[model samples]
Each structure stands twice: as C-alpha cells, then as structure tokens.
Target: MKVLPRQRKAVLINSVLGVAVLAGAGGAYSAVTSHSDSSARADARTVTVAKGTVLATVSGSGSLSSPSDAGVNFTTGGKLTQVNVKPGDKVSRGQLLGKVDATAAKETLAQDEASLTAAQANLTKVQEGQPSTSTGSGSGSGGSSSRGSANTAPTPTPSPTVDPAQLAQAEAQLTQAQNAVDAAQRAVDGTTLRAPVAGTVASVSAKTGDTVSGTGGNSTAGGSGGGSASGSNSGSTSSGSSSALSGFVVLTNPSGMQVTANFSEADALKLKPGQAATVTLNAESGTVLNAKVLSVSSLPVSSGSGSGGGGGGGNSSGSAVQYAATLTITSPTSNLRTGLSASIQVVTGEASGALSVPTAAVSGTGANRTVTVVNDDGTTQRTPVTVGLEGDSADQILSGLSEGAKVQLASVSASGNGGFPSGAFPGGLGGGAGRTRGGGAGGAGGGFRTGGGGGGRG
Candidate 1:
C-alpha cells in the first residue's frame, strides 16, 4: 500500500469535497420537505363560498312608554271621600274617578248664597220707591234774628248734597257678593273629579281618606270677581302644587302604547316618520310588535354618555350622545306594559333572493374586495372581486367570479393577517392562466388552463 504524498493529498481533498456536497443536498431536501408539510397543513382548512342571503339590522334598546298619559287630580281642597277607580282599573272618558269631601265646600257655598240673596233683596229695596226717615230742624230763630236786627244778621248756606256716593258703594258690594256666589258654585263642582279620557288607571296617589288641594291651597272656583282660578287653569300645574294633590292618578290608554328609542344623531337621520319598525319586549321572545315611526324630536335626548364599542376598547365607557325617536304601536299586545325593556329593529333596506357569500370569504381594503378561491388542483387563488350590498352573514358579489366557485375564508389568526399561504396564486394565477401540467399551453395531459383574459393573482 505504498503511495505518494501528493496522490494521498489529492484523494483526501476529493473525499472532503464529496462530504460537503452531500451535506448541502441533504439540507436542501429537508427544507423542501418542511415547506411541503406546512403547506399541507394550511390546505386542510375547509372554506366554503356558498349562495346565501344576508340581512343587515340596526339594534337599539328602549323602554315602553305611553304616548298619552294623563294625571287626574282634585280641583278643590278636601278629604278624598271616595276613590271610584283603583290602580289598573279600566275607565271610560268622563267616568267618575273619585270624590272629595264636599261638606266644607257646600257650607261655604250656602253662606255665599245667603249673602247674594241679602244683596239682591237690598238692591230690590233700593230699586223700589221706599220712604226713608229724614231729620231736618227749621227754627223760628230766623225771624227772631231778623227782628233783633242790628247786632246779628247772619245767613246759613244750605249744605251741598251728594247722595250718589252711597248708591255706588251699595252697587259695588252687590257685585262682590255675586262673585262670591259664583266662586262657591265652582268649588262645589270641583269636589267631584272625573276621568278626562278612556284609559286604564296607571296609578292612584290619593286614597279614600287623603286630603286633596288646589294649587297654593287657593279656591278652585272663579267668579265674576275676574280673579283666575287655580285648578281650572291647567291640569299639569294643578297636579304640581302641594303634597295633598302633588301626585295624581295616572290614566293611560293601552292602545296608545309607544316605544321610546334612544338613537344616536347619526342613526336618527336615517329614520323618518311613518317608517315601519318591529319591537321585541324583554319578557317575550319570538314575538314582534308592529309599529311605525310616529315622530322624531328635533331636540336631542340627553342620556349617559358612553363609548360606542361593545367590548373593551379605547374609552368605551365614555359618554355618548343620543336622541329620542318616538314610535307608535300599529298593533299593540295586552302583555305590553310600561317600563318594560324593549329592542327595536328598523329595516333600512332589503334585498329579496340576492346572491351573497359568507362575509369571511370576502377580504380587502375598504371598498376594494377580494376573495381566495380554491382551485380544483388543491391550491389557493386570490381573486379580485366587485362587491355589492353587504349583510350580516354574506356579501353580494357583483362580478369577477362565477357561482359554485370554491372560496377560502380569510384564515383567522391571532395576528389578524388572514394567514394566507405565501406564493399561492390568487384567482388561479395571473393573465387568466392557471397552473398547468408540463408547464405549457395545450400541453398533453396538462392541467386545466386559464382563459385568455387577464385577471388578478392570489
């Protein structure tokens, strides 16, 4: 085995070179295998692009309230003798709601009547030709003084007469008495409180023995005295007076039920009077109350301000602005009651039998939509698409893809990049040409070829 040093060195170098080459080839093979495994895992995700319908809805919470709520109060101050209706009692328009103790009112009325009668009698007596006793002393001193002459010659002027002043005073007193009588009569009328409208009794503030009074405890009756009455003015003011009549028996017509929705100013602009709405109460599920927008207040409704986002976000707890939108119930249910929580869904727009795909299947920057479609050969292709009306679950695709094409949902990831596989062609490759066998057009045993038109790539 004797060998030259140069020959041995050459053989060693060759062996070293061979080892390095083998290492490089092995590394390349491992990398390729790892990449292929990752791609297989990505392809396992099932995505479906289907033909379906979608609906967009605006949801807002509100409370049930009555459009017309009336409070019944006593016009005159007295003990409540009788409460004809209790809370929850149905009543009719002009039905007797309650009665107050009229003993004091009646007695005052009697006194006023007596005074008026006396005044009228005095007036009659004055009108009639009645003789009155007068005292006048005419002495013969006049003659005696005239005869005595010299020292005392004086004459007395007759006192000026003004008899109309006494008559005027009497007329004024008569007018005052007549006014008192009229006022007393009105107070008597106020003793009986009647329902102003047909409705159910929402609340009863006054019991049978409770004392009711007018504003400032003033008389409810007015007279020719030209003084304004208290309760006879406005009912709202009448009920706001004192504790005796502070709270009132509320009467509400159930049919007049309305939903008070607090909407943001932006959403309010989309709503209009006479728009249809569906109301769902908290207690009732699967039941909808039909309603219409009765009115939208020009003024904004003040509410607690808060952030708009649902979950934890930047200052979501902060204040929010809202406005009141009143909706009248077109069809009311018996179970609906005041103070119940409700949700309203207002349909802004609707499409019947429109084509749509899962919202997840469509992806893009705002207003520019794209989707990743799965090719028949187990590869992904991103296709640029023109989208139409968006909905809860799906979107309308205007163009760029045909029905029954498989689309991939944006691969959800914790990072939110949509986890699309790298190097994968979108829409089955560019220029309307798909991956093919033998890597040539019209090649024998080649895979499906794309159309001649150019398109986007995945």
Candidate 2:
C-alpha cells in the first residue's frame, strides 16, 4: 500500500487492460450463442427437396350455368287462358305449353283477309282492262263530251287507261293486307306458347288471367322464332313499338351444361379456349366434372343484380364486375343442377418428374432466388439457385439444385444473410395445401403430345 505514485499508476493500467480483455471475450461468446440460437430455430424450418410432379394452375369460383339458357316470351300479349306446363317439366320442339286469348288475334286475321280480297278485286279489274269503279265516272264524263261533239266515242285509247296512282294504291293495299295477315297469324301462333327446343322448363312467369305483352326481358328486337319468343318465325315487334310481354318460359338444354366463372381482366386474358380444367361442385363434394374451355369472352358478361338463374332461382349478391369465361363439361353430366356453386382450376403449366424444392425454401424473388442448403454436418450454406417454376408449394429447379437436398425456408430480417427466424414453417408451405408447382417457361415450345403433366385439381 505504501508504493510510489509511478508504481501504482503502472499497476492500475495493467488492471484496466485485464478487465477490457475479459469484457471482449464475454461479448464474443454472447455473439456466438446468439448465432447458434438462430441456427437452431432455422433447423426446424428445414424441408427436404425431392423430384415429383407440380401443377401450375389458375383457380376461380363461379356458378353452374346452361350453355343454352333461353327465356321464352309471347309473340304478342293477351289474356293468358291456359298454362299447360309447370316449372321443371321437360318439353320438345313445337310442344305446346299454354295458350293466350286468341279472340283479338283471330279478329285481326279476319280483317286482313277481307282487306286482301278487296285489294285483289280492284287489281284484277285494272289488269283485265275493265275501268276501275273509281275511274269509271271520269271515263263516262269523257264519253258524254264525245257525244256532245256529235262524234263517235273517241277511239278508246289503245293503251289501257289505268290510273297510276290508283294502281299503285291497290298494290300497296294488297301488300299491307298480306303483312297484316302474316302478323296476325304470327300473333295467333304466339298465343299458343310452344317449346323451341327439347329442354326442361326452368321457370314459368305467366299464369291464366294475366295480361301479357309481346316482348320479354330477354327478347331481341327481331324476336325471331328462337328462345321462348320469335322475330322471324313468329314475327316480332319492332324495338320502338314493342311492349312488355308476359307468359315467360325458361328452357335449359339438358345435353349441354357449362360453367360461367369470373376472373380479373388480367387472369381472364391468360386463359384460352380449349384449356383443360376440372370443376368441383360445392354442394356435392363427391362430384367432379372434367371440362375444356369452350370460350373466353373478349368482353365481360353484361351483368345485372344477377337475379334470375337458368334453374329459376339465382343469387342477387356478389355483383362485382369481372370478366366471364366458359368451360364445357365433357364428363358424364348427370345429376348436375344449374346454379350450383363450383370451383374450377385450369392448369396453366405443369411438369412431371422434375427436380424441385419447397417454394418457401427458395428465398428472394425472380432470378435472384437463394436457398440455405443444409449440409450433412448439421450446418447451412447459402446457395444460389436457378428456379424454373415457383409452384404453390414447391419450386421446379432449372439448375443449381439436386434431389434429396435439405433446405431452410427464407425468413431473413434486415440484411439478406440474417438466416431463418424463429417460427413454425414459412409462407404456408407445410400447411397441407397439397403440393402445387409454380412458374411457366414462357412459351417453351412443346406439344400436349410430348410432356406428361400432372392432373389438375379435382
């Protein structure tokens, strides 16, 4: 304790250096322990890479609809006298369903027939050189003038003396009469509602004693002989003059059933007609329908509140604007009901027996994907990978990976080399979504005849 000041100062400096050395060693140990703990957590996220099948698919939800959904309306409205069929009744072409009051239609036909007869009689008189009654008086006066001159009746003009205006009027009248008759006949035919095709009646919107019009909601301006109403065949009203029709009948073709699914504009454009797909019914879990893309609408289906379905009852909600596409069911379509909820998964791309790893195991996006390869010695090494298809669950390795390699899912924080964080699994890769492949080779030339793709969702 009685040491010189210089001696004490040297001892103090030595002691301070010893403390500093001890602190540095403790800090290094703590750093090492932190790194070890992070590694342990990452091991839990490790997944084994293997060779298998992967399916790249597009999915959307929609309701089952009829490829030939038709709404029936009367050619002309009248008091409904009879309803021969009920909803769900099967009908065939020309099959009579019901009739409206034909009293007015019959009267109209009779009037047109009488008018046609008058026009024909007049036209015949003029054609046969007989002076028409309308022109007879003028001719008689002309004859009187000839007599007053003490001269023989002026030689009747060699040419037939026919009034052009009268002749034209007669011809126009005949045509009008004929058209009137045709329209009246068409109205009569419309009075008796008939099936345009063999199908199950989905709905009957008319009843006896109800007054109806000639045009229905789904009718065209040229209400031809199609759907439940007709324009060309049954004679339709002009759009300007058409009135709301009653007696509505909806028919669905039993042989043809299709699904109408809505997707975003971007997704819809990715689909093409003839892409293979599978449809699963939400109501009947066991039912699966194999289908092919029949059409992809260039324009989104014009929608309303989605009120009426081909099956008669439809949902009125979820009216979001979306592009509509169709898939025709090729499988046995028995027991399928319209308006049933369905999910369709269309395979966009697929590959079989390709080297692959869990999608979560691949870190980074696009071309910079990296994987923490688990070494045999219980350690990890960051490895760059050339990923081909980043599937829903696993990714296809174009290069930089091999079968049976274990890798940890990426969960880095701050720096890119932060290793895996503490958690259970990563990005739903292990949550039993079934294995799905991702990515496409961007038009890699191949034919359906070559590569064996995995079956799409069922």
RMSD of each: 16.0, 14.3
- Residues 1-458 of candidate 2 have per-residue lDDT tens digits of 67669989999999999999889866755664478556556445677888888766777778776544455677667788988889879887778877778898899889988988888898877666644233223236434444345445333334557778888877888898888887778777767777666677766776788776665223453233323354212322212111222126666663567887877554676688988899999888888889888888788754444331111122334343457788888987666766778998887667799998876576666788788898899788889999886565677988887888888764432122222121111221111111222221111111212221221211
Global CA lDDT computed for model 1: 0.60
Clashes of 1: 13
| Best candidate (score: lDDT) | 2
- The TM-score obtained by model 1 is 0.56
In model 2, residue pairs whose N, Cα or C atoms come closer than 3 Å (at least 3 residues apart or on different chains), thus clashing, are: 72-228, 213-245, 223-230, 223-231, 224-230, 224-231, 224-232, 390-438, 391-437, 391-438
How far in Å is the alpha carbon of 257 misplaced in model 1? 1.3
State TM-scores per candidate.
Answer: 0.56, 0.62
- Give per-candidate clash totals: 13, 10
- Candidate 2 clashes: the total is 10
Off by over 4 Å in 2: 1-38, 41-51, 128-164, 205-212, 216-247, 252-254, 297-322, 371-384, 402-458
